[model samples]
Target: MTASSSIGTGPGRALIAVYGLFSLAAGARATVQIAGRFQEAPLAYSLSAFAALVYIVLTVALWRGARGLALVALGIELAGVLVIGTASLLDPAAFPDETVWSAYGKGYLFIPLVLPVVGLYWLLRRRR
Candidate 1:
């Protein structure tokens, strides 16, 4: 298959796998936080849930080779990481607990910060 047509094959498969994993991770974390201790940090748990939704959509978009949808999802993911990361750092009191995006995803080894950049590059590179 030509490289351009292989957006969901080869390396792109790995990207989709990562996105899928992140979706599950963030979703589970959010579920537990919201059910068990949401009173401790409602904003943090809600952001985790939002991040999970973005990752879910991104995984599907990448797997389906939907470039436009992937681009929009990646844009949202990157912006969330940046804004939430900064907010978490600037106002630690506001985030008594951590979200998937806290401290630029330090909890996830910075994958949340890096994934959108990589996904964007992958999608753009495959553009005609």
Candidate 2:
């Protein structure tokens, strides 16, 4: 397939690459946090693991050129970040730690908040 016609090629490749990196980061972080001290904050730890799973699904969807799946995953990611961010801010005691979306990914430099917007725009602009 030509580069322009495939989401996994060209610029989309960069997006996917970032997504892959995030998948690994979130997965490893969640694993360590959950395994070591899940009892400390079950909700936050579970959200971390869930965020990792979403990143994995989003990365796979983009790589495979599954537009619908990518859209859904990205949407969920956006909502997750917003909801989690707000909840954490409103109730600091509940979080007590960080999930990928906590504080809208302030811990990760807000990339998680922005990635989904870019991914959604890329997918929608592809004319697929």
Alpha-carbon lDDT, every model: 0.92, 0.91
| Every candidate's CA RMSD | 1.6, 1.8
User: Model 2: which ten-residue window has the lowest total lDDT?
Assistant: 1-10
lDDT of model 1 at position 6: 70
Counted clashes in each candidate structure: 0, 0
Candidate 1, 65-128: lDDT as tens digits: 7777888999999999999999999999999999999999999999999999998888787775
Which residue pairs show collisions in model 1? none
In candidate 1, what residue range of length 10 has the lowest lDDT sum? 1-10
Q: TM-score for all predictions? A: 0.94, 0.94
TM-score: model 2 vs. ground truth = 0.94
Model 2, 18-81: lDDT tens per residue?
9999999999999999999999999999999999999999889878888778889999999999
Q: How high is the lDDT of residue 39 in model 2?
A: 96
* Candidate 2 stretches greater than 4 Å from native: 1-5
